[model samples]
Each structure stands twice: as structure tokens, then as C-alpha cells.
Target: MQEILDRAKDCYDSGLPFVVYRKPNETDVFGVFQSNDELRSSKDFTEKGFVFAPFNDDNQVVLLQPDEVWEGKYQTEKSEAIKDINLDESGKEVHIELVKKGIQEIETGRLQKVVLSRKIQVRITKPPFKIFKTLLSKYPNAFAYFIHHPKVGTWCGATPETLVKVKDKKLKTMSLAATLPFIEDETPKWGNKEIEEQQMVSEYIGDKLAHTMERLEIDEAESVRAGNLWHLRSEVRGTMLPNLKVSEVVRALHPTPAVCGIPTDEAQKFIHKNENYKRTFYTGFLGELNLRSQGELSLFVNLRCMELQGDTASIFVGGGITEASDPESEWIETQNKSKTMLGIL
Candidate 1:
């Protein structure tokens, strides 16, 4: 671990990119250098020689070949099977209660922010990790990461959040992911609440990207649901100024408002104070870098994720909080989102 960390630090210092991975055998560490010798088209970046690492338990950031790619996805029908599974609180009910709680806290001036989370129970008659591995292999674009420590069993996920994407003069990013279990025939809709949250994320990102890019284009976003929840997503594209570096863009976009929350610092401080848990790598971004190419970057938000051990999986889940948010509902949202991975278990 120390050696890998040292190598990473060295790469950072030398202005290059690298990836460190924990192989399936558990205990084997591997490292790869991103090819930055040339600047290939962005299309090539998504199609060839890409690798991925754990961005968080549920999310993975991928570095692709810009050419070689596979099409894989899993969207389950709204399962009566899921209805049978036990959940801590009815999601709708929790939303109402948590919102009231958050409102009261704000009303009383206790906290300006609080992130709530809940767990959904899943019963599996078959081996859970095996099912997860199958899902990981299925999504060729997603990262297949699992660690088998004595403390945690098998952890895996196929995340879709792009923490950051940097090219020579361009940087792009997305915001606001909500997780819920997959439902059959669920079409994408731009509802009021979804639009509202997405708007906030877009505004925040536009502000950040403005400082780094000379020209920026914000797109009309659609709804994307990962695992059990749905998120409002917008694509923000910008061209970096002559003096800016790719690392600067990455540093600016990480832990965006979608995954973290608005009033970033205050929200993070509140999370540390009240969430009563350590996020560790849960929300951190991870992916490969193509130092050999002109520096193509693909990152994902660490959502719909879990930590895998031999026989036990310690799943980590959370939700974003806003001044307009409800704590109970946030809790249920995380629970519902956890279903993305929990269903397999």
C-alpha cells in the first residue's frame, strides 16, 4: 500500500497519470500507466485501452480506449420480489418525515445541512457475490472492483457518474445522481423536483467550470436512474484556458453538488458531524488516466456500491441534502438506491 501510494505521489509530481488496482485474488496489487504520448480523438478515448478502479463502493470511473467498447446494462422490472423484501422505512413515508425533520432543524437553527440514509433488506437464497460478479462482467464500460478482506466480503458496482473528464483544452462533468431500484418499463421524465435539483447542480458546475474554461456549453439534461434511484443529469462542456492544467479541472469538479450537496463546505461539515459514519472511498472519484494519449479522463460518482469480503458485504450508501431537503426521505432514497446492489445479494 505504501509503495503504491508513493508511486501515485510521484506520478502526481511528475505530471503523469497512473492506476492502482486490487486484483480478485485479493492481496495482489497491480498498477498501469495511462498512455499520454498522443492526443487521440475523444471518440477514441471511449473506444480503446481504458481501465477502471473503484471510485467508491457503488461507483466506478472508467478510462476507455476511445474505440473498444461493449454494450451492457441491467434494468430490472419493478419486482413484487422487492416489495417482499424488508425495508427500514417506506421511502415515501421516510421522505416526508425526514423533510419535516430537516425543516425543523433549520427552523430551530440546529444545522443548515444533514444527510440521511436508510437500509433496505434483501433476501438471497443463492450466493450474492457471484451474482454481483456476473453484473460487473456484464457492464464492460463500468469498473469491476471487489476486495476480500477478513472484515468485508465482496463489494461491487457499475456506476455512471463522471467525476471529471479532461482533454487538452476541454473539461466536462455531470451532477446529481439519485439511486432507486430498477423498475420495468420506467420511462424517463423531467419532473418538477428532478428539474429543480438538476438546475442547482448545473448552476454550481457552470460557476466552477467558468474559471477553468474559455468557452462553456451547458446542455439540456435528461433523467438517468442508477440502481434504485433516479438523478437529474446535465452535461457541462468547456474549453480550458491556455495556462490551466487537467489536474486543476479535476480538483475543481470533484465531490460535486450532486454527490455532496450545495453550500459545499457547510454541507460537508454537517455530514461529518451528524451522518455518524465514515464515507472513506464511498464518494471519492477513481478511474484510469491515458498519459500516453492526449490525456483522456473518465470518472464516475461512487454510488450504487458496496465493499466485498469473503462471505460478507459491507455496503455503503448515502444521499445528498439541500436546504429544501427532507432527512427521512433522504434516508429512504439511499435505501432505495442501495437496492441497485442489494438486489443481487
Candidate 2:
């Protein structure tokens, strides 16, 4: 464990590119370290290494080849200690207005739902390892990762949503949405807004995968907890077509209703027009693309993530908006989502 940590820190300190991650509910950690800093893009998604993709398809999808590899077990038996994180509310007014416009778009029959997001910069008092350690212990069910490269800088996350996982001809993915702060010993009473939002995502996923999968099955939505929030989630699984490629499945589901809106293209266009900021890889996907001879794939939707720079960190958070959304309440939802990363910081 000490040797792996030392190598990772050395790679980061020397400005080399690398990615170290642990999949959800997995004990072993795997790392892919680049020998030198160089920008590489995986356009066809055939890259046999770790990939860090962007929210928008227009941008280049960064890839880091596993020139050197490391693997070890990380203790998830207990959580690491965390210091209090100081966060100030920012961009509430702008986000609220954005949510209003999104609701209006839905009311006018333009979109059923649109996901909106914001970023808050908070001072960091510890190194990246400390934060990553806290994340690994805190969220055992999340795809926790720490990635750094000269081109993309540094981005780390504990994402709960799997973009897609392929083992041979078998394929599995998740449609997760709706958010409420988690309580200790009670079942979540999901409202209409939450139920509809989750259903929209599941339907969108099913429709998208209908062509590629030989058979599709979507289970009932269930309540799952991640960090300080509870989300309504459903699993969509099936067997792939005879010649279905992993890249095709990935591109088709890049921006699901969970991250974007019902009519994905239009909602994404509105987000680009009104958000007034680049999301980069915040709501994007990341993780191992192709591994070993069987060609297994595991990539996750980047949520509850932050970009680190100098002494401050940029934490990103967002929520899905529908006609039932209240501007003020949506604003509050974003705040609650932010605590997932903020609390561990």
C-alpha cells in the first residue's frame, strides 16, 4: 500500500499522467501510469487503457495508456478522518433562473426534463491522497477515482452511476436520478417528481439500447444512498447483439436522461446556451475501457466530482429539473448534492 501511494504521488508531483481507481464494492485498486506527459485522444473508443471523457461530444476524449501498472487492496473496513470543509453558497440566483427556464421549456412541451449544474470553489487544506482515501472509505458503492494529466489537470470523483459495463456479450447499465438528503433510519417517501424523473431515465435508456441488445430487462426503481443523499435508481441489463461493439453502446448512452434531459440533444443545447460555463468532465464518464482478453468494460458517470487547482478545488453539483420543479427547491437540491463532495473534503 505504501509503495503504491508513493509511486502515485511521485507521478503526480513530477507532472506525469496517471489514473488510479477502485470500482464500486470492489476491494482491489488498479492504476495506469503514463511515463511522460503527453496529450492522447481516443476517438473510436478502441483505446486499451483508462479514458476520461467529456460531457460534450465535440471535445476530445482524453486517454492515458497503461505504460506502467500497479494494483493493491485498499482498506474499506473503516473511513478515514476528515477535517471540516468551509463552503459558501454561490450562483444560487443564476441556477434558480436556469431551472425556471428549463421548467418553462417543459411546460411549453419542449422538454420533459433537463439536468442543470453549478460549480463552487473551496479552499483545500489537504493533499489529493487524503481526499481520495476519504472517498474510498466513505462510499463503498461508488466508482472512486483520482486522475491527473498535464492536459486535463486534476479531477477526482466517487461516481455512483455506471455508464455501461460489458463482459463478453453481456451488457449492464444504470438509470439513476432524483435526489433527497438521506436520513438515518427511515425509508424515503419519494414524491411524484422523483418517481417521474426516474421513469423518464429508465425509458430513455431502454429505447436507446433496444437496437443493440438482443434482450433487455429493466427492474423496478429502488432507493439507494450515496454519501449524504438518497437517489432513486434502476438497473437496465441485457445481452448484446451478435456484432455489437462496446464503443457503440458507450456513444449511444454518453449523456443519458440521468445527466442530460429527455430529448437529450435539445436539453444539452439549452444547457450549452444558458449555463454560461464549460462542464468539461464533471458530468462526463471515466474508468477502465478495455481490459484483458475478454474485452471487459467498466465506465461510470462522473458525479460528485471536483477539479483541483492550486489551493482551491472546484466542486460540481446538479439536479434534474421537470415541470414539477420549484426554483428555490431546485437551488436547495444542488446545495444538498454539493455536500457529498464537500463533506469529504
Candidate 3:
């Protein structure tokens, strides 16, 4: 573990690209160290390296060549923190207004749904690697990763949403949406708006997979807890059609309704015009793409994530907005979502 950290620090100091990650529910951690400072991209999954893509297709997909690899079991420890993050009330009001505008568009039938997001900047006292270690110890069930590239910047996240997973001819994905703070005493009672929001994502994923899957199956929706919040989740599985490439599947499933909205192009346009911030890689998917040795691919939605630069961290959070969405409640939901990263900080 110490060696991996030291190597990562060396790479960062030397301006080399590298990525270290621990897959969901696994104790083993893997690191890929690129030999050069070049930024690489791939459209097909034939490359043998780690891929870091952005939310926007126009942006470059950064890849780190697997020149050096390290694997070790992550040592887990309790994380103690002294600070509490306060919600930005003014920022919340601004996001609420954006949600209201989205709702008005929905009422007029411009789009069925839209995912709105906001960024919160916070001052940090701990080293970025220390916070990343805390995240690894905290969220064992999430795809925890710390990626650094001189050209692309540094990001660390513990994402709970799986964009897609493929092994052999079988493919697996999930529709994850509808967030609320978790309570210990009782079962979560989801409102109609939450239920419908989740349903839209499930239906959209199923429809999209139909294009490349010979047979598709969607499981019943259920409530799953991630950190301090609960979200509605549904698993979708299918057998891949003959000759279906990894890029095609990714193009179809990415920026799902869970992250974007129904009628993807229109919702994306709305977000681009009104969100007033660059999403960069917040909602983008990242992970191994068709690893040659394993013959499998696993990618996750970039949520519960933060970009570390010097002593400041930029945290990103968002939620799906339908016509039945409440602007105030949506604001609260993002605050709850922020706890996933803030707690470890």
C-alpha cells in the first residue's frame, strides 16, 4: 500500500499519467502507471489501458497506458472528521430557479425529464491522497478511483452507479435514480415523483439496450442505500447481439436518463444552455474497457466525486427533475448527495 502511494506521488510530481482504483465490494486495489506524458484516446475498446472519459463527447478521452501495474489489498480503517459542510443557500436558490425553468419546459412538453446539477467548492486541510484513502475505506460497495494526468487534471470518486458491465456475451447495467436521506428507524417511503423518475430511467435503459441485445430483461425496482442516502435501483441484463462492439454499447447507454434526461439530445441542450458550469467528467463513465487479459469491461457513472486542486476541492452533485419535481426538495436532495464526499473530507 505504501509503495503504491509513493509511486502515485512520484508520478504526480513527475507529471506522468496514472490511475489507481478499487472495484465495488473488493479488497484488491489496482494501479496503472503510464510511462509517458502523452494523452491517448480510443473509440474502440481494443486498447490495453485505463480510460478516463468526459461527460461531453466533444472532449478528449484520456487513457493511461498500462506500462506498470500494481495490485494490493486495501487496508481499511475508520475515518474521523471534524468538519461539517453547510449547504450554500444562495446556490440552492439559483439551482431551484433552474429546476423551475426545467419544470416549465416539462409542462409545455418540451422534454419529459432533465437532470440538474451544481458544484460546491470547499477548502480542504488534508492531502488529496489521504482523502482518497478515506473514501476507499468508507465506500467498499462503490467504484472508488483516483486518476491523475498532467493534461487532464486529477479526480477521485466513489461512484455507486454502474453504466455498463460486459463479460463474454453477457451484459449488465442498472437504472439508478430518486434520492433521499436515509433514516435508520423506518423503511423509506418514496413519493410518486421519485417512483416515476426511477421508472423513466429503467424504461429508457431497456429501450436503448434493445438495439444491441438479442434478449433483454429488467428486474423489479428496489431501494438501495449509498452512504447517507437511499436511491431507487433496477438491474437490467441482456445477451449481447453478435458483433456488438463496446463503443456502440457505451454510446447507447451513457448519459442515461438517470444522468441526463428523457429525449437525451433535447435535455442535453437544455443543460448546456442553462447549467452555467462545465460538467467535465462528473456524469461521465470511467473504468476498464475490454481489458484484454480479463476479457471483460466495467464502467461506472462518475457520482459522489470531487476534483482536487491544491487545498480546494470542487464537489459535483445532481438529481433528475420531472414535471412533478419540487425545486426545494431537489435542492435538499443534492445536499444529501454531497454528504457522500463531504463526510470523508
lDDT of 2 by residue, 174-268 (tens): 88999998888988899999999999999999999999988999999999998778999898889999888778999889898899898999999
Candidate 1 wrongly placed segments (more than 4 Å): 1-84, 88-132, 137-144, 147-155, 178-182, 186-191
lDDT of 1: 0.53
Q: Rate the local accuracy (lDDT) of all candidates.
A: 0.53, 0.87, 0.88
What TM-score would candidate 1 get against the native? 0.65
Better of 1 and 3 by TM-score: 3
Candidate 3 lDDT for residue 115 = 96
**Backbone atom clashes (below 3 Å) for every candidate:** 50, 0, 0
Which stretches of model 2 miss by more than 4 angstroms? 80-87
C-alpha positional error of residue 37 in candidate 1 after TM-score superposition, expressed in Å = 28
lDDT of candidate 2 at residue 235, scale 0 to 100: 87
Ranking 1 against 2 by TM-score, winner? 2
Measured with C-alpha atoms, the lDDT of residue 222 in candidate 3 is: 99
Mind giving the per-residue lDDT tens digits that candidate 3 earns over 316-337?
9888999988898888888888
* lDDT (10s digit) by residue, model 1, range 1-345: 445445544544454444443322133334444434222222223333444333232333344232322222233223323334454544456455655655565556554434444333344444543554444444434444432222122334656677777766567776654434456788655445556667777888888878777899888877665544556677777888997766567656766777666656655565555444566556665554563355666566655566543455556666655566645556656666665566556
Worst 10 residues of 2 by lDDT: 80-89
